[model samples]
Target: MNRRTVVVGTLVVAGAVLAGGAYLYNANQAEQAVAIANENAAVLIRPNSPIIGPEDARVTIVEFLDPACEACRAFYPVVKSILEESPEDVRLVVRYAPFHDGSEEAVGILEAARAQGLYVPVMEAIFAAQPQWAAHGSPNMDLAWSAAEEVGLDVERARIDMRSPAMVALLNQDLADIEQLQIGQTPTFFINGQPLTEYNFERLDEQVHEALGN
Candidate 1:
């Protein structure tokens, strides 16, 4: 290429890189602002929310999860591993963000399961059968119910409890947090009230360890 042409091309490439870098910086700043504003973990770790592991654990991992979300199902084991690895140091708090069709009903089912003292088993069962019941665009809710039944959840009683005022109130609070936190995706995680910028095992592990001061 000619010298002038090469110089022009280099300038264009340099400009693009600068612009991209600026965008990333701005985005990171905005995310940090949001994280700072929403650091009150108590708003999410309410009495009604599902808790896995020691309630008073030092490291709290809050997950905004949609039952029908494939990503949520995929992350279940990862979160489970974090708890299993350091049961006394880490705990998981789940907040429902059921954006997909029929996923709200699944959340209701989980609430009912909680009432029945079967939340953990039912949740595990649902995740295990997520593909069959949580199919994208055309979920098979019957299969979800069946999975709950297999885990000994009383479907009939659960239906009644799902419609209870208490369940409605809990769901409303979770929805409000979803909006206030500007959560646009399922399985959004926060470790010690700081949001996860990237979703990956290593990043999550790092955050967990950081929270534990390890």
Candidate 2:
């Protein structure tokens, strides 16, 4: 081949090789990102946990939320839908980071529900009927108790457990986790381990695909 033709052929081959290398590097990065996320996101699951979703799921979603936060309440349905749709594949862990004074009481009640193995039911009931009790302007223990009763919890025991040091510690630990993760607001979500700034069904699907090498 003439020099020009040989040079052109070499340039084309080099370009293809470079493009292939770039693709491989990107693929490696996506894999590493997912791995890192999973490692940072693993959290303890309490027995009879109120948290929803599968324990061994491919995607874990951690949410820092406040019981009295209106925005958190608003996001309830969306979270519910995500859980229902991905029951076996998505694990959701809820960490209470009460932004209001009344948040502690609400958090206590939730912790109590965990003790009773009624955590999920109580949380679902509370979110479903949030408009009724959350409007009390503070973490109304009475209202939280009422919601517990509505969810078939042993209201008296729930109330008693809510006052325990263990419950307080649990809430404090949740708060610490939120802080450690640098969560600044209610409804802040971490998917796997990375904070999800633009999370939606589409993005979740895309991330899951990348994670699974699809």
Candidate 3:
């Protein structure tokens, strides 16, 4: 065979090998997802996990998030867009990881707002003002509180509510699940029970679409 034919043959072989590898990896991941879905549903989907979207939606994206995580702040819009685009088909469930120094405080604030029926507004306000308060090295939760209050959260009541044992237990339960899953990242996502092994907008979109069969 000539050099061109030999080169083409080599490329084709390499392509097949890569494709096989990808297929095997996907199969393994799919099995793991199925196991998690069946055996770990109680841990993954507690009643108090914050949710946005329809309960009956076919696709559920569970996000293990830290309010102080810069990456989570960055990806917020990406996840929002996905939900907006697939309003009827996709749902989001947020579980706090609170990995940062002040993140547990932020989580408490969020739960307080939730108790007062201001969860979404307060969360958006806090997220919008994240940089002001979510200092990686030395966070000031006072700023986060101010942001929440600006969005109609009753600061005094929220403070009292945030200190409640119910809220503390809620955060602890989420942390327990995070530990059980061995999730080490702030914005880890699971789509339709499948852990997103790759983190990127395109990969996230692809996984959601694959689950939707779209």
Please give the TM-score that candidate 3 achieves against the real structure.
Answer: 0.81
Candidate 3: stretches off by over 4 Å:
1-39
lDDT against the true structure, per candidate, is 0.79, 0.63, 0.79
> What RMSD does each model have against the real structure?
11.4, 15.4, 10.7
Ranking by TM-score: 1, 3, 2
Q: What does candidate 1's lDDT look like per residue over 86-156, in tens digits?
A: 88989999999989988989998898999999998999999889889877789999999999999899999
Residues 1-214 of candidate 3 have per-residue lDDT tens digits of 5323433444454444233322222667657756765577667788978889999999999999888877677667667777878899999999999989899889988999989898878888888899899888899999999999898999898889999988888888888898877777768888877787655555677788889898
Better candidate number, 2 or 3, judged by TM-score: 3
- The 10 consecutive residues of candidate 3 with the worst lDDT sum are 16-25
Better of 1 and 2 by lDDT: 1
Cα shift from native, residue 71, model 3 (Å): 0.4
Off by over 4 Å in 1: 1-30, 33-42
Clashes of each: 0, 3, 0
Residue 93 Cα positional deviation in candidate 1, in Å, after optimal superposition = 0.7
Pairs in steric clash, model 2: 50-119, 50-120, 102-139
